[model samples]
Target: MATHPTFITCSSVSFSWPDGTEVLDDFRLAVGPGRTGLIGLNGSGKSTLLKLFAGELTPAEGTIRTVGEVGYLPQNLVLDTALRVDEVLGIAATRAALHAIEAGDVAEEHFAAVGDDWDVEERARATLDQLGLGHIGLDRTIGEVSGGESVLLRLAALLLARPDILLLDEPTNNLDLHARARLYDAVDAWSGVLVVVSHDRQLLERVDQIADLREGEVTWYGGTYSAYEEALAAEQEAAERMVRVAEADVQRQKRELSDAQMKLARRKRYGQKSFENKVVPKIVANNRRAAAQVSAGKHRALHTERLAEARERLDLAEEAVRDDDEIRIELPRTLVHPGREVLRLSGLELQYGARVAGEFELRGPERVALVGRNGAGKSTLLRTIAGELEPVAGTVETHVPLRFLPQRLDVLDDELSVVENVARFAPEATANTVRARLARFLFKGARADRPTGTLSGGERFRATLAALLLAEPAPQLLMLDEPTNNLDMASVRKLTAALEAYEGALIVASHDVPFLESLGITRWLLLDGELRATSPEEVGSAVR
Candidate 1:
């Protein structure tokens, strides 16, 4: 592997949000030329670190140094729909200048604009092609392309810049399988210092190293994400064993202390009895009793100190273990019979995007994965099925109660508490009943009473899901659109865990292969102007 000098360095850096939420404190990181994947749970400061490196945010303290130019692709990239592809790619001026010079304008400013970048257009085209965006012409408006294509276009822009340090945050969050493959290729071929913050396991697998950020500290792990998982598993296992040992030691210390106290009490009783029986002179007996009492107190103090030290050891051992809990809930009321027709679509055509010309049926407790590129109408289709949108062409028939969790997760009332939002769905249930159900979704006690607007992305998602699953009439068919978007790996796992307990028919639209596979999908449909049944293996192999 070719190695370069450290291109990005952060020393004792500190950063906080506008609300004074401390994200990074005394953070130190030095990265050389290679691909490094940054991963952590949500709210662990991964995005903040990238922003700091890109100079989008100033550090509260310490220094940051970089060797050369830097390019950063933020997680939530919102490009103006009115902007043309060339302008978005930052090549409009150069292309215009080249055109002027080619027309024999002989303008000095045009020459200055086209200076050393005479082949800029060709380079831009090549970059676009590399990122699977050749079909998107530079003159086309941004509104003409899909979300996935827009992401690729942005990455192509960064690639055209050819910065020494490249930072990508959740670059594959909205990409399909084909777009993701192209991104993986780009990462594989990158020669400069690249740091990407993503929860995509496949993307992380292509990294040269893994940097796990937890509690404002970074722990470097050699090799791919799988290697890091193996190392972490081993570490967690050892830590748990130590906790068991420490707990046992604490128990033993307490017992020993109790035994010492009991012995001291018995000896004190014997000495008092001897003094009362007048076995020696009264003054000598009293002095002997006082000495015995002092000795017993010293003995008890030593045992008490040992017990405290043992309890401290137990606390330290427990701290070494990670506390990541999966969502566990039961939805027995949502069960569907094997022969029941849950949903049916007959010649349904969406308002804008893809259309279904043929009849489609979903029956029983089938778990269907809806895989498609962005703007292929996956979300529109789900909304149409949920009756949230009126189709322009055909009909959607539902045989049972169904609920849809939109990608935007706007189902909740921001002003209302999580419990109130859930209660809105389950009107017949009492407030206590709603709170009881929300607890299973990890919203116990005051957490259930927090306003929906106050929750983080993951927390908001959980709250929305709770509202959906706890709805009245017990939805027998659940449709989720891009459910894993913006969720960390842990949150995704929690979502999967929560879904596992749902005994209803499910249709989840997502590009995350690992998450889809984990759901035990019995059917796969590719949405590309039409819905076609496909296999998981075909899904993996069809990413051309």
Candidate 2:
């Protein structure tokens, strides 16, 4: 691996939530000047670590040191809608001072405000242009920009500040392909220390190294995400082999212990028989018996010790194997016949001016992928079909029962447990039946009783998905909007596994091409101003 001087360090760090939930404990990290991909399962404290580095959160114990200024872009970027673009860029005052001086105000305070940055406007415009936001005017309000554009704008602001350390948390969560490319370009151009917590494979592929956080510790992998995966796979393979060898050794030890015990019993029996037959004098026989018993005890202790040691080695070997469970669900009731008409859209005019002229129909268990650029009204269309939105002009008809899982995962009630939430969806299901079904969704035992509000990002998603798929009348037509947005790679794989078993019609809106392709999508529809049929190969060009 390439090496660089350490620019940031955390020593003996510890942090916990006010609710007494421990996050990081005695954590130590050294970050150098390179793009590092920080990854872990949901709730692994990747975000919290970034927040600590960015000084957004303080460590309960230990010291953190940074060599230069830090800029952080949180996962949920919430900017005041009313703030002007210049204001958000943190140059509104400087721009105002420059303008005043240009208008012949020439005050001392204005000069002080402007400082040496007489070309601040030019720099801001150039930064915005670099991020593919040149069209967004400095005078415009944040509300005027799209979500993807807003993310880039935040990054642009950080770039303008010329910070030496930058931290981005799930920067590509809601971004479109074009915006993601722009952000990737920005990452490529970064020369300072950069750490990004993201699950986007394409984004992680650009990193110089992988920092895997698990069980309150960070393990460094010497390359990109793919390299890390390869390394981890090799490690697991070795661990499994060791486990097999250890298991064999344990079995061998157990057999030896059993054989030794049998031999000792046989020896005792022979000794007792000899004594009964009076082959030797009573004193000599008794002495022989005492000697035999002592030897048997030693033999038994030796075998027992060996067996215990072998079992201990087996346990250590097993602990090396990872147990990342996958969701395995079967929805037989959701199956649709090949000739069944699942849904139809007639003269569909979505709330955001995107429309489907004429008619659109879905039949049987057809899988549809909704592909579009940001602000292309994909979500709006899905919402319209799901009855959450009143279409400007259209008719949506569903022959089979349907369900929608939105991007926010707000279908769950925060106060309710996972089982309770699922019960609400499937009112007719008995409590025992609900619990049995939840186990298939990977929520067994106490996990099913966890309140929705306290679940992690991945857990919350699974719970919501369970509630939808396991509803009273199993939904035959399911609509999902950006389902993989913030999910980790493992969670994404689990989602794919769950969907593979879903025997129903699916309409998923996503920018993740790999995920879409894995679903065996029969149709690809691009939503711009109008819905149009397209192929997977044509999606990029059509969206661009």
Candidate 3:
């Protein structure tokens, strides 16, 4: 196979919506055969940029140039009709043909678009076989597959296209840890130029570079997401220092300019008349000129220059902070009263269809972590604790005020704006008051008015937390189910940072080991018949 040229290049690009929303300015990005982590806040336009590359939306200004075939994956794709997994992959083989043909780069115009990687079609078959999906019949209907399975099948189809550049947006959001890890492995193995947007920290860390979009611009950093973050922080700190120095200089200049003008004014006003004969006209004229030159506009412009510097520094600082979009639960109030035994379930029983609950003894702070495999009743137990479910015959003792941020954040009213959501959460709050608070979470002004449903997953989580925090005493017990599922790495960091500072207890269930470890989780529980907290290692896949 012949090597391809650069996959894509963007220069002096600026983009925005038809409604006059600015996504970015002077944005630039260059990509090739390596992993690149694409990131930005909810409204940061990461998705918009991808659309441009996909030929779905044209850039409002500037240019985007690319060579070779491209592959794209989107988060939360809706697949209609019925088709088998193998059929989808096979269908993809047919689709790649048009693109290569359109690009006029195929060795042969009539050559099949997607086919065997090597000299045979078996190469493509082997890829699907490795994914444990070889058995899925192409003749079978697609509707039969689970949501996760559907996502996997879609990925397989995209992969089979074998484009030189792949653009993936939240490709891992709907997949389980096992499935997600599998996708990661495929990405790692791929020789194609991979550009992905994901909140998954582990995914971001694997990328060769990070591209940050803000204020209509993109900053390219050399290294992984973490390294880029550290460097950005350092840059922000330096910018802040420069701003401070500039501001001080502006103030001092203002005072000196004021004094000079005052003196010049006095000299001009007097000498032109009674003392006219005593002083030279040239001296008076010179004084008048000097005083005129020192107009208020000049003074204001200096201050404006200083302010511009300050603004730049602030923008840099904000960009660095924005990189981590995960929500931090800032409980507005701290409440305590629960004893060491925040939760206790003895002989606690649970049943789903035909599966019986696992058995166990669990007692600890309100900060309990329910650990179990999917469908193992971890969620069932949480629902039970939240009164969403009733145990068949187990004694239950819980003492705490629990507020749950579910794996799904539908608790947020999609029709309402961020501000509206906050106001509803704290109905007692005035519109101005709610807006002020949401602004702190970066949902400022019109952004707060954007429909909650319009927000990116990261933005939605932040808004959800903001709504929760508005509660007066704050929730004493915070229960999170699959909390890190949709959050990006930056968002996860912010969320964990905030949660770490929280004084209230926490109960979270998730399969993300990295997230669990960062939270200092010690014990785990299985969805057996009852609730039990055990060692972290014990938090393995239990039979449902």
Candidate 4:
């Protein structure tokens, strides 16, 4: 780990949405010059905090200050397709001014616009080249480039700004493998106060430190994301051990309290019996009973206080335990036989004419990874197979029921609740049954009733998955296009757990190598212009 001067600070910062949901309150953070990966569970306000740092969102209370200029790249970057590449790189004015000067029309405004960046054009071209966008000329419109290239173009713009602080929110969301590598190189090369909000483990590995935002507070970890995970695991293990000890102590205190009560009751009974038997003088007996009662009362109070203290300790110990919920659900009905033919693509050609070179067959409960560059038509292929889009040529035949979980997760109705959405898919299921299944997707109790429109990125993804899984007749083939996009690590884990139980054939189009590997993918296909069987190493090499 390294240390640098604090360049960004937030003091007593508080922010809440219009719905009165507080994201950050009395928050305090100071970031120094270095790459710091910002991570948190979904809805924990990672994006909101980045927005606050970028001054895109004003805090409800307190103040934020920065040492110098800031540049921010949002998660959902929407550049006007008609805009030229130079404009996106923010060098249009400079290029124009330089051109005018070269044309011998040296106006004062043109010189001012050019400033000291006389080499701006060269710098811009170099930046674009660094991000693998050199082929995309400055004059080309954004619509002419791929989605991943567009993202890099945005980053190139930020680099051109040369801001003291750079903030990126899920910069690799829609990027392909090669694009991710390009972005990773950019992050590794960054020397400013860089704070990136991302769940990409590979990207997080490039950071000098990790800022774990949890429960509205930032906890600094001394190293990368893996280091943070190791520290967190050790902490949780110790906490669990403490909880066990506390539980034992609480039980001991309870037993002691019960024994004290029993002893006091026996003494009271014996005293009454002695008094009735006339074993002593009435006055003596009265004194003995009074003394005994007072002693008993004190003993009872002491035991009660001890018990309460023990319970409090137990509660505190329990609070230290992490709440890492897993998605647990049975998917027996979704299972497919090993001999069953689940998918067959015969000379399939997508709308954009990225064709499968020959016949393809996916049998049994095979897990397949579809790897390709961003405009390589992975989504188009998946949609065409799902019957959402008609293919340009060839035929796609499915022997079993299938479901496609698109990148947008638009299958869910925004107006409906999570349970309601599931019910739509499972029309035969009762309300209670729908809720019971929804709980396995991590939507339980009142949360299951939350409108789909209000759910966070991860929650919405889970709800969409639940709908697809719980649909009637059970889909034996599930297709997911970049399912891990925008999901936090926790959500990714939950999804992995859910998919673990799925015995259906799965064709997932994703660039997340770790996630794809975790799925135990039986086959890997690279769809550049034609689909071909490939290995992970080949895929990595191709992208690199």
Off by over 4 Å in 4: 1-6, 329-332, 337-346, 351-353, 387-400, 410-434, 449-454, 471-473
lDDT of 3 by residue, 1-544 (tens): 1285657888888776544567768778777778988876665777778878878778877899878787777665667646555566666444446446557867563374544333223544566565545655555577655455566777787776677778888876645566667787887787778889887777888888888776666788988878988998888787667656656665666676667667656655664553455555676666665665566457556666655666665555554543333333455555454454455565666545312333333334335566654335666666666777777767666665667776657779887777877787777778787787787787877888887766766778778878878855456667887776556556677778877766666778776666777786645655554444476665543421
Better of 1 and 2 by TM-score: 2
List residue ranges in candidate 1 displaced over 4 A: 1-32, 57-67, 329-332, 337-341, 351-353, 373-375, 386-392, 408-439, 443-457, 470-474
Give lDDT per model, in order: 0.85, 0.87, 0.67, 0.86
Q: What TM-score, computed on C-alpha atoms, does each candidate reach? A: 0.87, 0.89, 0.69, 0.89
Q: Give lDDT tens digits, candidate 1, residues 21-70.
A: 57789999888888999988766788878888899888999999988788
Instruction: Please give the lDDT score at residue 141 for candidate 4.
Output: 94
Question: Candidate 3 at residue 34, lDDT?
Answer: 80
Better of 2 and 3 by lDDT: 2
For model 2 the TM-score comes to 0.89
Q: Per-residue alpha-carbon lDDT of model 4 for 1-544, expressed as tens digits?
A: 1233548899999997664667889999999899999998877888888888998889999999988788999876788999999999888988999999999997999999998999998999999988877788999998777667888899999888888899999899879877888899889888889999998889999999999888999889989989999999999999999999999989999999999999999989988998999988899999999999899999999999999998999999998897867666456467788988988999888886699867899999999999988878888899999999999889999999888998867898888777888999989989988888888878889778777766666777778888887897888998999898878876677678778778889999988888898988899999888988899878887656
Per-candidate clashes come to 0, 0, 15, 0
lDDT of 2 at 401: 88
Model 2 misplaced regions, further than 4 Å: 1-6, 15-22, 58-64, 337-342, 393-400, 413-438, 444-454
Q: Clash number for model 2?
A: 0
